[model samples]
Structures are given as C-alpha cells and as structure tokens.
Target: MQQYDVYIERQKRKRQRLIRRLVLFSLITLIVLGSMAGYHLQQRAVYAEKVEEYEQLEDTLADLEHEELLLEEEIELLQNEDYILDIARTNYFFSKEGELIFKIPDESPSY
Candidate 1:
C-alpha cells in the first residue's frame, strides 16, 4: 500500500508539471502573437502614410510638368513677332502707322 501511494503521488506531480509547462507555453505564444500583430499594424500605418505621400508628390509633379509645358508654349509665342506686337498693341495701346486707336471707358456711368 505504501508503494502504491508513492506511485500515485509521483503521477500527480507529473501531471502538475505538464500543466505548468503548457500554461507557460501558452502565455509565451500569446505574447509573441500580440507583439507580431502590433508590429503589423504599425507597419501598415506607415505604408499607408507613404502611399498617400507618394500620391500627393505625383500630383505635384504633374502640376509642375503642366506648368512647365505652359511656360514652354509662352516662350514659343514670345518668339513670334506678330504675337508680341499684338500683345503690345492691346496692353500698351501701341499702333502701327496710319492706324487709329479708340479709348473707350470701361467703367459704368453713374446716372
């Protein structure tokens, strides 16, 4: 009977040790999974921000390229003598010989 009691005690201790090891392993696994989830969330946020910034920069680049094209068009127009003369005539009231310019009032008359 004493040997049987000792064997039963040893079996109970083994079961307890197994339970402890399982609990420890579960806690460690939970900790590792939580950390990985947090890291993934952080990296996703960063990637989202970078993607938004890249889109904004792309829009800015497109705008600058459009502006550059407009400037090139203006440069080409300025190279033409007729376009320059037309601009000077409209803005500065410059006229060729034998041409008459009428000065019209643009403001509304207060009656």
Candidate 2:
C-alpha cells in the first residue's frame, strides 16, 4: 500500500509538469502570432499611403505634360509671320499702307 501511494504521487507530479509545459508553449505561440499580425497591419498602412502618393504624382505628371504640349503649340504659332501680323493688326491696330482702320463700338447704344 505504501508503494502504491508513492507511485500515485509520481504520476501526479508528471502530469503537473506536462500541463505547465503546454501552457508555456501556448503563451509563447500567442505572443508571436499577435506581434506578426500587428507588423502586417503596419506594413499595409504604409503601402496604402505610398500607393496614394504615387497616384498623385502620376496626375501631376500628366498635367505638366499637357501644359508642355500647349506651350509647344504656342511657340510654333509665334514662329509664323502671318499669325503675328494678324495679331498685330487686330490688337495693335496695325494696317498695310492702303488699308483702312475702323473702330467699331462693342457696347450697345443705350436708347
């Protein structure tokens, strides 16, 4: 009966040790998983911000390209003597030697 009691006590100690080890392992696993989830969330937020910045830069590039095209067209038109003369004739009231200049009133008469 004494030997049987000793055997039972040993078995209880072994079971307790096994339970403690399992609990420790579970806690470690939970901590690692939680930290990994947090890191993933942080990285996703940074990626989203970078994507937004890239899209805005693309829009700015498109606008600048459009402005460059307009400037190029204006430069080409300025190189034409006929277009320059037309601008001068209309805005500066310049005329050829025998041409007549008329001043038409743009406002309606207040009757």
Candidate 3:
C-alpha cells in the first residue's frame, strides 16, 4: 500500500508540471501575436498619413496649374505692342518727346 501511494504522488507531480508548461507556452504565443498585431497597426497608420500628405500635395499642384494658366494668358496680352506701350505709359509715367501725356491716377494693385 505504501508503494502504491508513492506511485500516485509521482504521477500527480508529473501532471502538474505538464500543465505548467502548457500554460507558459500559451502565454508566450499570446504575447507574440499581440506584438505582431501592434506592429501592423502602426504600419497602417503611417501609410494613411503618407496618403494624406500626398493628397494635399496633389491639391496644391492643381492650384498652381490654374495660376500658371492665368499668368500665361496675361503674358500673351502683354506681348501686344499697344498693350506694352499702355502699361509703360500708365505705370512708369513715360511719354515720347513732345507728346501730351495725361496724368490720371487709378486705385489698383501694382504688379
């Protein structure tokens, strides 16, 4: 009876050790999975921020293109000979020799 009692005690110890090992492995697996999930979430956040930045840049480029078109049209107008002489006379107050120049001031923004 004593020998049987000793055998049962040893079996109980073995089962407890096995249970402890399984619990430790389960905890480690959970930690690794959690870490991987956190890393992926961080990556997604950074990607989203980059996409937003690129979208803002795209909008700025579109506005610049519109401004460029207006400037190009203005340049075409300025290429005309009469328009050039008018701008020179009005803005610079320049006149040809012996020509009657009109002095009329206007409220406008300068170039």
Question: Best candidate per TM-score, number?
Answer: 1
Alpha-carbon lDDT, every model = 0.99, 0.98, 0.95
Give the per-residue lDDT digits (tens) of candidate 2, residues 30-110: 999999999999999999999999999999999999999999999999999999999999999999999999998879787
How far is each candidate from the true structure, as Cα RMSD in Å? 1.7, 2.3, 5.0
- What is model 1's C-alpha RMSD? 1.7
How close to the true structure is residue 38 of candidate 2, measured as C-alpha lDDT? 100
Displacement of residue 85 (Cα, Å) in model 2 is 2.6
Q: Which stretches of candidate 3 lie over 4 Å from their true place?
A: 95-99, 104-111
TM-score of each: 0.87, 0.79, 0.70
lDDT of 1 by residue, 34-66 (tens): 999999999999999999999999999999999
At residue 54, what lDDT does model 3 achieve?
A: 100
| Per-residue lDDT of candidate 3, residues 8-93 (tens digit) | 99999999999999999999999999999999999999999999999999999999999999999999998898899888988898
Instruction: Assess candidate 3 and give its TM-score to the true structure.
Output: 0.70
What lDDT score goes with residue 56 in model 3? Answer: 100
Q: Which 10 successive residues of model 2 have the least lDDT summed?
A: 102-111
